[model samples]
Target: MGRRVHWAGIGPNPLRRRVDRAEAWFAMVLTVAVVACGPVLVWRSGETAYDRAAAAADWQRNRFVPVHAVLLQDTGDFIPVYGEDGKAKAAVQAEWTAPDGTRRVGPVIPPAPGTAGTTVLIWTDSAGNPGERPDSDPMGAAIGVGLLIALLLVAVHAGVLLGVRWWLDRRRMAAWQQEWKDVEPRWSGRR
Candidate 1:
């Protein structure tokens, strides 16, 4: 029987459902994996890059730089700190768990573009090692999880759709075969 797998409405013509989604367990597993893994992959790579950039700079000249382009003032957080010299600079801070339980906090000078808010990024002078210089890839993580969820959904959807299409196509082809069979009988022994 000629049938095509349905995925995003794209299929091979004169198609055959070579693959069967009878178990559906595999589809579920893929969905779970995509939803679980996408964010980890995206965030980790981003964080690695951030670490590389952080390593390149001198910690003594600690400053706040956006990981992603965003406005600080708009977020309404005062930032940028200074040392005893009164020269605006970054400072090293104690690292520990924050009351927020969900996130950790550290001492920050809160530079001109400083804030605990995710909107503003905190930079550290290699020496300063501001607590804000977290290795956590929050943005990457968020995006990765989002993508993962989307992928999982897409995979499941594709499986469902393909199954339905396969069933329909099989039915239709069976009918056509039957019709052809009937026609053959009627035309038999005719000239």
Candidate 2:
């Protein structure tokens, strides 16, 4: 038959010290606190992230306008430029009609590599200035925030647990030192 494993300070035992009992109880309370608070933290973080993302998306949709621009020169024949997505692109002089019905020519980075006269879609502000693409995925942002919060919670819990264990070990060592001081004198017949 296998012997039952005994956890220190978990149950009544004559050998258990006060520090051990305190450590066990503290560990239990910390576990309960994590279990109770983890979901709430993740939910709140996710909600805040989603709200900000959605608001930004709405603002971008209303503020930016899409227009077709024609490339004035060939790309991919010179040094390649990379976009935020790490995709290869190039900045070339292109011409487009602005919202005010006036012709505008400027350096624009097309979404893909193309030759001269290739028409490509580009985003422009109300003043016809080129802008980066807006984020449209609020759900993705929420999920990412939720996951980050959850990871932080786990890290905090582990840190707290380690701190409490270190404190308890210090206390136990102090108590053991005091006990040894008392016993050593009698055992050596010096008291």
Candidate 3:
């Protein structure tokens, strides 16, 4: 019961050139295919990203334990990594009591920038070595994957349409030039 569509067809008319017909068919098919495939591609990409994030979280949970620590001094160790919030990251020396009730000292990445004596939560391995916390934010993973898929879809759609349009435009111009070659002399009264 859907409305029937009329595809562009090649003709003898200069306005309905072969290149125009080809571009029309290609564009229609590409639009339909991209629209149908967008959701599936996005879903698959999101799933892959979620799986990796969940795996990392599971690994961290199994290997690390959270502990409260107090910064001993500002060791001033800075890494070039920036958080999603665009804040600079740094490592500072801190001391915490391990599960075995032994005082352990090492580098701790505070939730925010902190000076000496600032109390913060830190994760440590069973051997009392400092480590990263388990990432448990599902929203973060979803947003990240969604943005990536959107960008990819936009890029692909633009590239396909523009490439085809450019090619057809060039062909149409050449056809116009060839027709003019035959007509220009007669029109100018030279023949």
Clash list (residue pairs), candidate 3: none
Q: Tens-digit lDDT track for model 3 on 87-148?
A: 77777778999867899887777877777888988888888888777777655796699779
Q: Please give the lDDT score for candidate 3.
A: 0.79
TM-score leaderboard ranking: 2, 3, 1
Candidate whose TM-score is highest:
2
* Alpha-carbon local distance difference test for all models: 0.48, 0.85, 0.79
What's the TM-score of every candidate structure?
0.30, 0.87, 0.72
Q: What is the lDDT of residue 92 in candidate 2?
A: 85
Candidate numbers sorted by lDDT from highest down: 2, 3, 1
Which regions in candidate 1 have their CA more than 4 angstroms from the true location? 1-134
Report the poorest 10 consecutive residues by lDDT, candidate 1: 66-75
Tens-digit lDDT track of model 1 for 1-191:
23433442224534433333432344556556756876676566656555655554434233433222123232233343555558665432323222222233444444443333334445443333333443444455555555665566677668875776587678778877999887887789543
Query: Is candidate 1 or 3 superior in lDDT?
Result: 3
After best superposition, candidate 1 residue 96: deviation in angstroms?
A: 16
The per-residue C-alpha lDDT of model 2 at residue 62 equals: 83
